[model samples]
Target: MTDKTTSPPPSEEPAGELLLTSPPTFLGSVEGATVEAIAALAREGSVPTILQVPTKGLGPDLPDNVPILWDRHAQKPISLLEEVRAAKPPLERVGTAVVTTLASFIELTNRHKDDGSAIFAKTAWPEPKLTAVIDYHMPGETKTARRGKHRIAYPFPLTDEFKVWVAGHGKTFKQADFAEFMEEHAAELAAPDQYEINTFEPMFKERFGTPAEILDLSRHLEVNVGAKMKSAVRNASGERQMVFETEHTGANGQPIDIPGIFIVSVAPFLAGDAEPEVVRIPARLRYRAAGGEVVWFYQLYRWEFFLRERVQDDLARAAKETSLPAFEGAPEMAA
Candidate 1:
């Protein structure tokens, strides 16, 4: 009858197939990991790439096989993006290159006991020398909007002391804000006197103190003039909150029994023979409890340094000599 062999309707392409067309080669297992991976890719070649990573708070660490973590938990993505974007053009212009990895950064930060906080107490360490000045702009929030101010400025001051430490040991300027904050409030932090008793002592006494045993308990606990003090108060609802800080070092040599908080700050400055100024880096390390160990994790933040031409030249020279084969030539080509 009818020679109607109608062709079947054309099938739509599958979404997975469409994605495979590009085939994302440069991928990470976390969100901000893109920055470091992209930077690495740029150093290798100006190849376009895409990265994928686990969403925030999904895990404590980067997923297995992921090349980089980007330390998004320590710093926000927008900020990191801004830094990379701002640094890109200058680095390219000067023929310089850089590669950052989460594993390298973590290793750098973990090299010292107490994360180099001990250096501050050494007194022999030279005072921080001004290098480049880094300017930080706080993110806009509802509270800032209400105040008609959207940003707060931060300054990072770097010193030769820190540079030496970084050169010999791969230390990072994480928690710089805590260090800066503490320096700002140094005058306010004073050790308690012998006559003064901390707020916790009353609780200790009420739970375990007799009038005759009070002095013995205090002595047994090693309470003395230089001891730090702290207090916690319970509201009518029986909820407890810490009121203030004093001074005390935990088993890990962290400021556990201290009364006040320590905050770090950062700024940019010039260093080495490089005439052009660079970003100043500062950091602070504080002790916190984690996994039954008194470990220290830093809340690293940085200030912006407008990437300059000369600085880029210096970086390029350095990159040419380092592991960045793309800057010089591919390994096979060089061979």
Candidate 2:
């Protein structure tokens, strides 16, 4: 016969683990006394893990030893809790002493205050969700202590107002088309504007700065005209515009998605019929959010004014079937 041993009910089993959930922003605050309490508990041989929910930017800096995880929206909700519980010894349930700091979540939801006030509870499942607040810190003091605290400024979302402003800036000419335009009108623009820098170019430099770097692709040894670009919008400001989407990966390898629209503006120079019908065509990058639904983030490169000499040289070289000179200074990959 099998041994007749009685098993204790689940509630009377060995102690379970503690799990804390909070917005990443709250984790860094000086007012995170509750988190500090959890950290202390964790240091004292208690197994308390933190689950950080994503926000607009980088999360708070945390200790190296704390076992922290992410609550990715892509994954199943509370899956981390289930995972920890499943990995525990016989009678322990994960999230037995779960605490949540809902302040960040609340602000994100309501778009308001940034106080570190939170909701604390013993969050075991199959039991009443409410429990005693571990930190007896009062709200009024927290509010008073945090008066006029400004949060770190985050990137503004694209709005309809910004889109209207971008639309009013007139047509965007594609880089390739503008290059070809420069090439086609090379003879007309070559001599007069050859060495002359536009007075407004200095202002442009002050505003946008020099190019981050340039990719040198002159070595392949072929002469070609800039291609006609595909248009996203037909005629936003009376001229066909080309919109290009690209991604920027920072030094840390994080990818930033961006959509840049190129607008080419031409101002006539009164060189008269005797001289070349010289015109100053400024090619600019109109950068909006990746999806093209938001406000303009920035005006990136001052393409025409900066690259005028290079463009003219390349066009002249292509016309004569001469190999273009290789770019110097930095390696191509530096860009």
Candidate 3:
């Protein structure tokens, strides 16, 4: 005869070992039937573990020792019971706060105001300044308080916008990548000419930043100039502009105006003066014929001078934009 014994159901068994401590801990669920070794790790008192949930189910049995933080969208519809906490009590706090988003920050500000006042009140707080980590690191309240009553400081992480732009000052890009670099800093190319920057360049696939007819004509000339380019730009439509003909018309009873070899405009990624003071750069277009192919390239006259002028103009503009005191020297890390 076999020994008759009753055992509990599988569901009734504890999912895992739960440590009832200051912050209740759950060291992951148990594995399948295998004798495994456990290594020693810091206990609840030394290093308490935090649990994050996507749902707002603070359901039936919650341990008082554990606190769960779930980022609930502040504007989402909530239950009547959720409203109870708003009027519960008047608590005071003077602790430092760093909100994750501007919306959340605004929500918090609105929540703390008097009964019927709007979240975006006229007396609402000003935007807190984003100070560098070094400032927060130094000793004192002036740095902590920052510029306003509400403040948020960030650790100078590499991905921060300011950090990224500052880092770009030291970066180098390949010729192939130069176009992308120009695109990214396109705004820097627009300080002149009110707000519109008109340019005619032959490299791009389509007409841009210039009058329809002008750009179309420029691209037409560019693609038709060489046999290789003609092959590259030709389409199935077989539409070609027969601009040049095999004939002799030195002057058709009138003086022909020859387009200047130089292209006069602001250099890319450079600050240029408002015209008619804009610099005129001569771009000598010369084609290289080798290996039965033609490659086109241009040499800009006075390019170095243009760069030097732009840098000086940029520095001068920087000085004019702000009233802050500045000195000419390399920037140093604030100790």
Candidate 4:
């Protein structure tokens, strides 16, 4: 197979042969083609930069091939169908970051919204400031998701304006408040007396389903409590856990945080004098022996309430900074 970059030497061929030399392709006529290949095709066809996402027939039933669903273009892009770019604003996000730090986010926001002389605007030419639609993940899930890694996207207010709002109305443009905010959150998180898990109550373990979340300890489970390693081990060679279920209480009370970051975005920036996120919630380790396998239990203090209150507080702050009315209710996310 010939690569896109290294094409075969030019050679004259018959008209019939020339037709087969390069098959005509629109934007996405070639599947799994590289961006360079798509760009080459677009240039050859004079495709417009603007594009549109498709919709489905009215109210298609389940299992039906519905175009209205966004997943149809989840992996493949909309413009590849024929154009180099979307004809107008797209409802879809440009991309996602599997791992994003808080600092990287802040830096990107400042560059675009505050100072874009070098990175975003290189030509010294006039152009609308760029805004990216993206989804990003951070360690530790909050109450709503009930899962590790906060998948931030819509309703989380991951916008340039929102970033500025989070930074306290662009006060310093350094996102100076983020570290303080995170530290306070961490302190509160470390001690969540707010959680009310009364296992002693008979109603807890009734005829109903088991309320506790059960997880099997495995290599995939990575635990980080703080700057230093906090671990308790009974037997290294043991199958899963130590001799007793609750013997190894490594870093139970101690709470470590993620790297000190200001914010994260596509553009590179300095770390500045930031500290690791004060992701304060402390964790508890408990285990049970079941069928010769150990089931480990880890819980975050005041998790659900914490996540909700944190977001709400952020909203209130943004409102105060922007001099706008705070949104009273939770924002709905559409599938």
* Among all candidates shown, the one with the greatest lDDT: 3
Stretches of model 4 off by over 4 angstroms after superposition: 1-279, 282-284, 330-335
Clashes of 2: 4
What does candidate 4 score on TM? 0.24
For all candidates, what are the clash counts?
41, 4, 0, 27
Error of 3 at 311 (Å): 3.0
lDDT scores for all predictions? 0.29, 0.30, 0.32, 0.30
Estimate candidate 4's alpha-carbon lDDT, on a 0 to 1 scale.
Answer: 0.30
* Model 2 whole-model lDDT (C-alpha atoms): 0.30
lDDT per residue for candidate 1 within 217-310, as digits (tens), equals 1122211113232222122233222222234433233442332211222112333333434332222223443232222232222212221232
Model 2 C-alpha lDDT per residue in residues 82-201, reported as the tens digit of each score = 787889987421122222222222223133212232221222211212211112233467443322212211111222322332343444434333333333433322111322234434
lDDT string, candidate 4, 133-246, tens digits: 212222243443311111222133233422322233223211112223333323122222223223312323311111111111222122332233233322223322222222
Model 1: which ten-residue window has the lowest total lDDT? Answer: 115-124
Per-residue lDDT, model 4, residue 8, is 86
Candidate 3: clashing residue pairs, number: 0
Please, what is the TM-score per model? 0.16, 0.17, 0.26, 0.24
